[model samples]
Target: MPVFNQYYYEPLETKDVLRLVALDPATDERDPLSCTIFQCRRSAQRQEYSAISNTWDEQTPSQTLEIRCDDDISYVRITANVDALLRDFRAREKPCYLWVDAICLDQTNGEEKSQQIPLMGRIYGEAKDVRIWLGPDDRVTAKVFTLLRLLSQVLDVQPQWHMAERVVFHLNEVFCRKDGVVGLKSLLNFFSRSWFSRRWVVQEAMLAREAIVHCGRYSIALLSISLAATRFLSLDVASYPVNMAASLREPTTKRGILELLWYFHEAECRDPKDRIAALLGLVPNEKRFPLDYTAHWTELYRQVASLAFGLNDRAINFQLLRVSAPCPIQEMPSIRRGSLTGQSLGNGPYLSFLTYETQTPTSGILPHLNGGNIRFSPLTEASHGSIGIPQSAGNGVTESPT
Candidate 1:
């Protein structure tokens, strides 16, 4: 028996230089996946390549792939998800250049991983195309893609149609058909895929110059899927990970890093620190937290809270604190409990104050506070508190503050 040579990554020379895998085309389905790693400067013009946006399927055991580096043929273990993607690409007639994180980056080297992770936005953004892999096609994949295409066509035809009108059209034209029911269920299943909920895809999709979603042999423009999602999914029900990519591209709905964090909090990542790191690219450099995977999760959380508080935008700050749940790490400061008036304290200790009111009966609607002079002073110890501002009753009259 002959032992296969093990592949090893050459260290990236500079921050601007990264690896790209050139996949060797296979004529037979049984052929092993083969690729060559080569260095490329990200800043170089006229470099055509596609980057993959995918969820790592860690649940499955790893599989080996043939990698030709320099003069020797070597084998490297890759996740099952990546193996599937490579196989799909390998079946093509011509060789293709691709930036797949799992294979292109040196996963074992922490330093290399840290450096490459931050550059991912630029990597995807600069690429001629971004391919989103939602794993291989399943039973409902064909129906979902067909439904997306049909919906996208409807949207393209009536681009200016109002939301209500679009909903009506969907109900009458799309949903009214016999197969439409099955298609709708398939669409639901499609959106429910793990790919949609992955944290990294948010930035990947948002930054791509052009993106195509690939499932097995099926492919479609990401814009088509986004448009279909907007037209079909209700605003309240749609998860930010699945729905916010298109909105983020729009100038009017552009959000800062803090807002992005709040919206994409539920998006999954293997590392908790990545919850902050993944969205850093979308925000301006000044607003970005330092990209340090080595930092403790609590430290990252604190930095986020600190940055949010530093902004001193009452509305944004209020929203930030209101939505923040108690951190699982107890040592971390509770910014929610710290500031009542939502003012910057300049690294001073934060204090919390709770307001209570007597119960008044009329309609079920709670009374809104009109005007009151509330005093605030810094306290020696930190604590958590809540301020309840009830909804305004009819007649536009607000209850006097007690």
Candidate 2:
């Protein structure tokens, strides 16, 4: 062998950037994140490791656990039993969701972690409650637990937990943050977070989208990787053709769809491809680093029928939005920036219209009148030396307000 390449390679998004794969530090060490409550068990399944990691012994062997939190924890004392820990937690009378990486995933190594990385947004997105143990030094757990409790609760239809739990999107802490369709409780208004923390700032703005939390000020790099790695093109789910009837039922308004659109937009605009990369982050000059998310967006749309929005959302008329026909990233990168207008290319409302549920974060929804094709190699490149928008008006899109 040759030595590792150190040249700076600019990725379209974040996950491409290599992040420190920090493991739980040794027990003897002053690990700031130690002492969180966790439950573990041997995994029935196994994952493979390689020389890259073996040479450095950088990771622990893969293992899975049934990490769970008990509803009753207030009764336990020091040196408590499992049931006791449960009692202790409950005695505080706090409502929280357990954020166990081992319970939620296999901590055997990187690839397994990588596959689950995309779901980070959703996991963080859906969880009504989040927390961090903060070990000895007072490390931050992203305050996921506290955020959940603060979000206003909406007493919408009681979710069929048995059914919803099947697809609870345990990954995002958000019920379907896994994309089966996670949602925030209605009436949640997080305007006060800014007073206490800087972390909650972006979380709040992204949370604002509700449909697609995590964008703009968030880690662009991580967003890129998750989109690139998503298996949307090969989505396998039940068929759900657009319901013309539902579209007319209430006229597709932004009420039920804003969150979904926000989710789509965040995923689409990510330049790199993964969450770890998001940790590394990227600069957010839209012109210098246009998001390369055609692949994931295409799949997001392709899986509409399999997602939460079925007959209820597919039917709304899209005539006013002038939404383009449905297409996949295999077709072309979506670049609306006209060559002459250059950096100032601003797309308007109809541009927001999407043929499929996830392709674009359009405020409106519409049916495709044109051919069924995939939009390949979209506006992936940041530098626009010569290319311009499609001359034909048939396939282009516009942003909501514009």
Candidate 3:
């Protein structure tokens, strides 16, 4: 057996340059997968290619895929998830031009990875459209797509139906039918895929000018899926799937890092630091915390805490404490320590202020000093509004301080 050469990446000439892969069309299903990598200037003005957003399935076996870097043939090991996606592309009639992180960036080069990480938002946004691979289709894939198409049509007729109770009731009635029930179940199964929960997809989906979701051969516009999810929420169904899709439709620039972190707390990433890093794209001031893969998780967490506290927004600061308290990083102390003080905590006045606030909750602080309260009212009540309640005895149904 002849040994195939291992592929090597030539250093990217400039910070603005990145690699794109041109997949070679395969004549037969059994033909070996092959692609050619070439450098290109990364900019939104160049819309010659699509970017791929996919979950890297580490549990699956890796396959050796061929690459043509220049005049030499080389091979790289890829996860099954990527292998399946490339194979799907190979089956297409024409070659696809794609910006796939695994293939385009030199994973072995830490410097290259770091440089490419910050450009991810632009890379996805600049692409003509983002292609989301949800792995091979299951039995319910067709049903899920069919139902999403129907929901999209309904959304087109009336885009603002989510807030209307009558329309929500009608949608519930329609989807509760036998066939619709089956379809809804299929939709649930579809969202249960790993792709939806991956931390990075949040940014990829939000930044894309257009996005197409692929499950094996079946492909649908991501907007259709997102609209269907919105309809799902108007019916008062569980918001697991809706939470994943609905936010993608919103402008990424409006949300802050703290809010993004809270919203996507459950989203998983391979690297612990990526819990914060993945969200950089959606945040307005991404430069506030630059991407540094080499930094320790504790260092990153402290940097995030400092940024949140530095904002001087009381609501955001309190919310940050709530979000960071349960974080798995043990080196950082919680409010119970009287102060979030330590080498990792850094020396900031906000820490001392937070410490004082934590201990003085029972000292007759007003409702505004705390993070406000949620008021309960009967379903028949006409006017539902929030009222401030002082921290005094005999206050009717006041929320306890966190």
lDDT values of the candidates?
0.63, 0.25, 0.65
Off by over 4 Å in 3: 1-4, 43-47, 91-94, 155-181, 313-315, 318-402
Clashing pairs in 1: none
Positional deviation of residue 190's Cα in model 1 after best superposition, in angstroms: 0.9
TM-score of each: 0.72, 0.27, 0.73
Tens-digit per-residue lDDT, 1-402, candidate 3 = 135476778999888998988888887767888888888876434438889999886655368778875577888778888888888766456778988888888888877877878788888888899999999997767756776776766634444454444334433454565334554565667788888878899889989999999999899999988877766666566445567886678775766665666566567788766777788877776435676777655455556655655665454455334424332222233322111112112343233222222212332333324553322111111111101112222223222222
Query: Cα lDDT for residue 1, model 2?
Result: 11
User: Can you rank all candidates by TM-score, best first?
Assistant: 3, 1, 2
Pick the TM-score winner. Answer: 3
Per-residue lDDT of model 1, residues 1-402, tens digit only: 125476778898899998988899988867888888888887675458899999985555378888886677888878888888888776468888899988888877888877888888888888899999888798667666776777666543344446535544554454456434554555667787788877888889888889899998899999888877767654234555446544534541346665665556557777666766788778766666566666555455555555654665253434333323332223223233432223322332122222212223223222112122222222222221212222222224342222
Model 2 scores what on Cα lDDT? 0.25
Cα distance off (Å), candidate 1, residue 22: 1.0
Worst 10 residues of 1 by lDDT: 366-375
Best candidate according to lDDT: 3
Supply candidate 3's per-residue lDDT for 372: 36
